[model samples]
Target: MADATADLAGASPAKLTTADGRPLKSALARAQAKARRRAFLLVLPLLLFIVLTFILPIGQMLHRSIFNDGFAANMPQLTQWFVDNPVGTEPDESAYAALAADLKSAAEAKTIGVVGTRVNYEMSGTRSLFTSTGRKAKNFEPPYMQAVLEADDKWADPQLWGTMRQVSDAYTANFFLAAVDLARDTEGKIVQAPEDRRVYVMLFERTFLIAGLITFLCLLLGFPIAHLLATLPLRYSNLLMILVLLPFWTSLLVRTTSWIVLLQGQGVVNNTLVATGILTDDTRIQMIYNQMGTIIAMTHILLPFMILPLYSVMRPIPPSYVRAARSLGASSWTAFRRIYLPQTLPGIGAGALLVFILGVGYYITPALVGGASGQLISNLIAFHMQDSLNWSLAAAIAAVLLAAVLVLYWLYDRLIGIDNLKLG
Candidate 1:
């Protein structure tokens, strides 16, 4: 029975083994495993580097989007007031007195202003109410709620105070709510933006449009160049390939600045056009500081990304396929179209995807070339970080960008099959 049990256990063979029936019992097997372990250990530094440098920062940024404390942290006194005031029909004088004293303290300390701004973004006119009460509270004596009501009857509405009570949580979905230009009601319902503030939805639409246009332009401009480079003799193709890669040697800032210089009214392009009498001086195209400038610069920058992928793909396709099509009585264009284009579709899809993905999150090129009307979503992200000093809002925008990238990647993988992609 013990022998059978030992045989059953041994029936599961070792993972590493010699060609013969013996398992990996020799020093060579041990040495191989040791080498593999050493190889894994060698890569450990890179694994830790990626986790610490890339993954942790992204995780932390995403966390901040829903982990804000602006309202709850600053308005502890307000929350205490609400808790002390029971479900009674009338407001209690004792709670009201405490609230008045606390409001005065919050005003002087600027905590009320902080909470007020957080609330006003959701509930309009809340800032004015907070500031007015906080600033003027020092003059009011005991029974200050009555004095507060006398100053602004809005305080007694209960609706205003109820709204305040509803939003006393440490974490909120406010940033995500504002991203799509909606806000939550007192009952935690999604509602459309107020008429005057309906800009974000339009901005989101504009961002997608710009990204799509850039993708189209990259594909169109890149396909022909990639085909030529892939098909031509090595002597000539190598020279052309150098030109394609030359842009990478130059600084991106330099490239953007060069576009600005060339495309501006008093710049080289307009000057050349006017001098050539192609158009009147008054009609010199106003290209810079506009959407057109953004498109032109971005297309130039991303075109190479499209070309490289397509070129790598087309180079490997044998010339005999086109020759065979022609031998079958196909015209040159027909042979190229039927035989060549289908083959290049994989490359085209890959190039288009790469360019589109990169173009979506572009910030520097757009910021430099694009004016107020031309700013991409990334520019708005930068604005939240710099001007508003709202790190949570910035993180929310970044999270949205990341989610968009993930969705695009998922759709691409589903539609195109990343496993079938051939880099060469």
Candidate 2:
């Protein structure tokens, strides 16, 4: 025993080692690093896919919101003149001369219309000014200010000069300001847009209000169905779930068209009501092609999203808790309110966020059913993209919508924790 003790005392501590003779700690770290690298390699394709498809498009839209070169690219000389001169400077002879040279060059290049169109967005009726001036540009001699003003007396207007100065820069916030129904006056102070042009803010408010109503409707209609499914046997619940999922199998256009048929003035519902003597033919309700149609169609379409989440959260909640509460003299309503309803909140948050986000971005249903007054902000964004062809304004509107969604998502994360969002 003494010899063993002396041997152990004399021996150096045995270092922990792997089979390959490396220290165990180092081996474990290397293994962990290798596993982490393998995991990252497996996920790299998805990351690249998201960056390319989602992140890159959003970044491009954001860049387009502030960067436009219609005036700068076509009228380089005038752009440079604006750079040299400060805002609110009255145009002198040199400024008019620079404008004359730029107009002449733009006319020759056939880009005068492009520059005019760019300026027309900011100051209505200026496209004609740019085009007409370009047409008579070569006739102007020295002392071009007076000669140019002779072509159009409107050129002498300070408001026109201010607008030109504002748009002369290659980058601007005017599109964003316009998106929010604001504009910069000749004095360079931000002000409310003209009352007639103040539509975007109203559209945004309408969009949010409608989306909230749709979310609430979905929750109200879905909660009872979800609770029934949760309480039912698997056989019955599966049959009921098929009813909920049937809408998903149908095309959205087909469903929307069906609603149109059902809701139109002379369509099925009105005809049935009239036949039943519930309403006179002359007093048939006008339902389709309005806000009411949009709400009914969207609620039906989004109901499953609410039902599935609520069902998933409720299924795991044992009935014994409610039964125990009832046995302890609690009323059914009290047991549900205190012991059951709170548990389903995670599902409520998940469903409401999903439905609200999707509803805000809805285009087809609203476009088809929602008439002039019923139209939402997304409709205007599409109008700018397709009809107006003002892509910068479209980008600005889209950027604002995207920002609002991100803010709501951040708020949800803060309040409810994203980890609690369970779809199943």
Which candidate should be chosen as best, given lDDT against the real structure? 2
lDDT of 2 at 414: 94
* Candidate 1: tens digits of C-alpha lDDT, residues 1-424: 9997787577654544566745665757778999999999999999999999999999999888877666677667766766655433355575567657766888888788777776675677788888888788788876776887777777776556555665666677877777777876655578887778776667767877898899998888888999899889999999999999999999999999999999999999999999999978899999998999999999999989899989988999999999999999999999989999888877887888788878878899999999987888888888888986677777887788788878987887898777646545
- Among these predictions, the greatest TM-score belongs to 2
Question: lDDT score of model 1?
Answer: 0.81
**Candidate 1 Cα deviation (angstroms), residue 91:** 6.7
lDDT (tens digit, per residue) of candidate 2 on 234-288: 9999999999999989999999899999999999999999999999989999898
Model 1 spans > 4 angstroms off: 1-36, 80-113, 124-141, 147-163, 422-424
Q: What C-alpha lDDT, on a 0 to 100 scale, does residue 260 get in candidate 1? A: 96
